[model samples]
Structure formats: structure tokens, C-alpha cells
Target: TEADPLADAVAAAVAEANEPQPSAPTGPPLPGGEKDAFRVAVGQCWNVGSLSTDALGTTVVVAVAMQETGVPDGGSIRMLSFSGGSEAAALQAFEAARRAIIRCGARGFPLPVEKFSQWRDIEMTFNPEGMQFR
Candidate 1:
């Protein structure tokens, strides 16, 4: 049986074309000033003074939707996931994280406007470990 070179080339071309194209360029996973700074800002407001022992032991990921003015949409704040503790503990931790954002968010974050899309939908992690409890 003779190999069909044309058929193979056509298949390869179709496969390449079907592959998804890369989206716009974005920042690296870490060390990028914008994202790092954003996290730091949120962390600065992460108050853990009244958190319970179990809550303090848990870690959670908070999902927040942001407005164009750098303010978070109150209704859109939710806990996406958690670890290191029970569901009850996670809820407690999640509340702490939510309050943090709300507290410091009164005046809105100072993120750049042009990069709205990047910070528009944020999923931030809250780890109570290693944090100073007052």
C-alpha cells in the first residue's frame, strides 16, 4: 500500500488550525508587581483577631467580582474552595476573608484602570497559618 503524502499534509494542517490560539499576553505566575501588590493590599486588611481556633487553622479561596472603579461587587464575593479544616471552619475563615475585602475596600483598591480585566475577577487565597493573632 502506498502512503498518501497529500492526505497526511492536509490532516496535519487541519489539526494545527483547530488548535486554540493563545489569548492576550498576561503576567507571569508570580513576582509580578501588579498581582503581588494586589494580594499584599488584600492581605494587609485580612483581620484575624476574632477568628476561632478551627477557623484559624483553615485556608480558603475567595472569589470576588470587581467594578471598573476598583471596588468589589458585594454580591459577587463568594468562597470558591477551602482546605486544612472542616466546612464549618472554612465558613468562618471565609467570612474573615470577606470582611477583610469589605473593610479595606471602602475607598476601593488602587489598581490600575487599564488592567481592569486582569483584576476584574479575583480568586484570592486566605491562609491563617503564620498570621499574628491579636
Candidate 2:
């Protein structure tokens, strides 16, 4: 089959989206290292008490587009993919993920204003394995 430019472009875009993000440039380092800072900021509001056991154990990758001002574009928040549970359970997990982002980030994350491009969009994996349940 001949190479389709549109297909190739879409594939490249998908590949770039799935790749891990580069770390922030050197300056004021985030409190818990560069990468983990994103996690710690959003993870604090992840309340799993109401989630099912299956949901709590599942990992869901959530994606969101952001404004330059550090606020996540509300309509862009969505679950990209999930595993280790039924779709129903994954939905539960995704809701928790959504809540965490919306709750803790209502005022927007404390990302550096100058480096907005670095975080204009992000996909974060919410894995419950490391969380401590009550």
C-alpha cells in the first residue's frame, strides 16, 4: 500500500502523545522532584473511599488540555485508557481521577507561568497501588 500522508501524520501525532513528557527545565525545582510534582499535586484529592475494590486497584490514564494560566480545560478532561478491571470499574476509577483534578486544581496547579508550554497538555496515570486506604 502506498504511504498516506494523513495516516502518517496521525500516527506520528499519536506516538508523540503516548510518549512520556520531558522534565521541566532547570530553575526552581518542584518540591518532590520534577516528575512526581505533578502526581503529588493532583493525587492529594483522590478520594477512593467510595470506589469499588476493583476500581481502587485499577490504573487509569487520564488526559487533559490546559490553558496557559495553569487551569485545565474542563471539557478536555477524559480517561484515555485503563486496565486491570472491567470497564464499569474503570469508569469508577476514572471518576475518582476526574474528581481529584477538578477538586485540587480548581484554582489551577502551581505550575510556573513562564513554562506553560511544558504543561499545556498532560496525561497522568492514576494508579491506586501506592495509595493507602482507610
In order of appearance, the predictions have TM-scores of 0.73, 0.72
Winning candidate number (TM-score)? 1
Error of 2 at 112 (Å): 1.0
In candidate 2, position 52 carries an lDDT of 92
Task: Identify the runs in model 2 with alpha carbons over 4 angstroms from their true place.
Answer: 1-32
Colliding residue pairs in candidate 1: none
- State the local distance difference test value for candidate 1: 0.82
Task: Report the lDDT tens digits of candidate 1 across residue range 1-134.
Answer: 89899999999999999876543324433238877777777788888878888888899999998887989898899999999899999999999899889887878888887776567788888998754444
**1-134, model 2: which lDDT tens digit per residue?**
89999999999999999886665443343344655776787878888889899998799999998776778888899999999999999999999989888888888887876666566778999888865434
**Deviation from native of the Cα of residue 56 in model 2, angstroms:** 1.3
Q: For each candidate, C-alpha RMSD in Å?
A: 6.0, 8.8
Model 1 residue 59 CA deviation (Å) reads: 0.4
